[model samples]
Target: MTKSQIGLRERKKAATREALSWAALRLAVERGLENVRVEDIAAAAGVSPRTYNNYFSSKAEAIVSRHCDRIRLVGEALRERPPAEPLWEALTRATLAPFDGAAEQPDPRWTAAVRLLLREPALQAELARAGADAEAGLAAAVAARTGADPGGLHPRLVAAGVLAALRAASDVWLRADPPVPLQPLLAEALRQLAAGLPEPSSS
Candidate 1:
């Protein structure tokens, strides 16, 4: 195929995927997340059920598709940071980097969809799975940058902690009434992560 043909094909595929994702999220918000069926979502996207399956294995997966790119984006951002930067600093920047280009004005509808994902049991599980993958990717990148073993304990532990901070901050942000900007929330999470989750309690 010609270069233009390839570009067109790629763009078409991306558009189709976005359509499916938007359709699924819309249905999930309109109805309950559990109430939406793959067929119904596909119909909403003007695609066949088979096509929906081709893009995503389950309804929860479809609903959270937009966030998947954010995971990889975080990983890539961390990888590109200056070598002298500490892990927490790099993680803070990487984690919130995706929202830099997003509209400063909060999209109420989109926030509602995020709230739905956080509350829905199945979608929460899917989100956790995505989070786990992101943690692993970040760990691998960190290990490579530091010349440490990717599969070793330190990287794994740090990755888990960082991912946990991210999850906790996101949960808080999702429910924030009048919703604060995500960047500050994420930075606070990193600060908490840096201070350590463990502390000496007043006896």
Candidate 2:
């Protein structure tokens, strides 16, 4: 196949995946995650149930994939950062870049879906699976920058640490009573990670 044909195929797949994710999240929000069926999501996305199954294993996976997709973008952003930039700085910027302008104008429906996911055990499990996939991609990106083997411990550890920090920061942000901005929480999390996670002294 031609390069253009490959590109078109990739774009079509991305569109289909995105449609499924949006439909899943919207339906989950409207009818609760437990009540949203795979067939329902496929119908909402204008795809057959088999097509939906090709993209996701379950309704929870489809809904959680929206956030997982952004995590993958973070890996891409890290790869695109200037090579001369410090790894931590590049990571910090890349990690938070996707969330820029989103905190200020939060989408109510998205927020609702997130809250639902946080509360649902099945969705959390799907999110964990998604995170593992994101971590592997991020490890490859980090390896590319550091000239380490993608499967080596150094790249994998760094990727895992960065993702863990982001997860912790997200939990804190989500639990905040007034709903703190995610970017700052994420930035601080990365900063602390970069700073060697110094222990705080008792006052």
Candidate 3:
């Protein structure tokens, strides 16, 4: 196949994967995870059950993949950033790129739905498993940008640090007594990380 054909094929596959992931999350939210089957998710995505099987082994995996898709997109975004941009700046933009046009404040109903879905034990397990893969994807992107070895410590640390900020930001967002905009929290988290996480002076 020509290079353009190959690119088109990959884009189609990505769209399908995203469709399945989003469908799984929506169904799991609308109906509890236990009530939603693989067939249901596939149907929601307009794909066959067998096609869903090609992308995800379980409903939990399909749901978790929605987040993974964002992480993977961040990697792609980083690659496209201008070479002169500082690493942390590029990373911040890359991370937030997937969220552009997102409401500064997240909708409470959507947050509630996500919280309910995340409480599932099976989904928790899937998140734990997926975290490593997410980190590796980011690490590879960092390596590619800096010409570091893909397996080296620097890229690995940078990836781990970014993920840590994301998780911290997420936890704070979810647990905030008075709801706050996630974008600011996310930006702050990355800024702190890039600044070496300085100690706060006591009042």
Best by TM-score: 3
Residues 3-57, model 2: lDDT tens digits: 9999999999999998999899888887888888899999999999999999988
- lDDT head-to-head 2 vs 3, winner: 3
How would the candidate models be sorted by TM-score, starting from the highest? 3, 2, 1
As a TM-score, model 3 comes out at 0.84
Q: Report clash pairs, candidate 2.
A: none
Total clashes, candidate 2? 0
Clashing pairs in 3: none
What's the TM-score of every candidate structure? 0.79, 0.81, 0.84
TM-score of 1: 0.79
Q: Give the residue spans of candidate 2 off by over 4 A.
A: 1-5, 101-113, 149-152, 199-203
lDDT digits (tens) for residues 71-154 of candidate 1: 667778888999999877887887788767544546667777768566878888988888888888988987877788999987
Ranked by lDDT, top first: 3, 2, 1
Model 2 lowest lDDT segment of ten: 101-110
